[model samples]
Target: MAIGGVTIFATLGYFALYSNKKPEASAKDVAKVTAGVAKPGNTRPR
Candidate 1:
């Protein structure tokens, strides 16, 4: 029972630290795609 509890907490902690973090390359790729589809006048300023 103690081992199971520890395992569960470890899993939760791992996800808490890493779940919302994305790769830098992936973020840049998404930005490029979004900019590609955006209208010329509606784009964000750099």
Candidate 2:
């Protein structure tokens, strides 16, 4: 039971830390980040 709880906590913690806060982006936004350029709404990956 302790191990199961720890596993669940770890999974949730990882997602909270590394999950993409942006679920959707405009084409212009996608283009900028991958091209190593910055657009108005593009954010670098955390």
* Tens-digit per-residue lDDT, 1-46, candidate 2: 9999988876665455345446564544554554556655466433
Clashing pairs in 1: none
Instruction: Evaluate model 1: give its TM-score.
Output: 0.43
Candidate 2 minimal-lDDT segment of 10 residues: 12-21
**lDDT of candidates 1 onward, in order:** 0.49, 0.56
Candidate 1 off by > 4 Å: 22-46
Clashing pairs in 2: none
lDDT of the structure predicted as candidate 2? 0.56
Q: Assess candidate 1 and give its lDDT.
A: 0.49
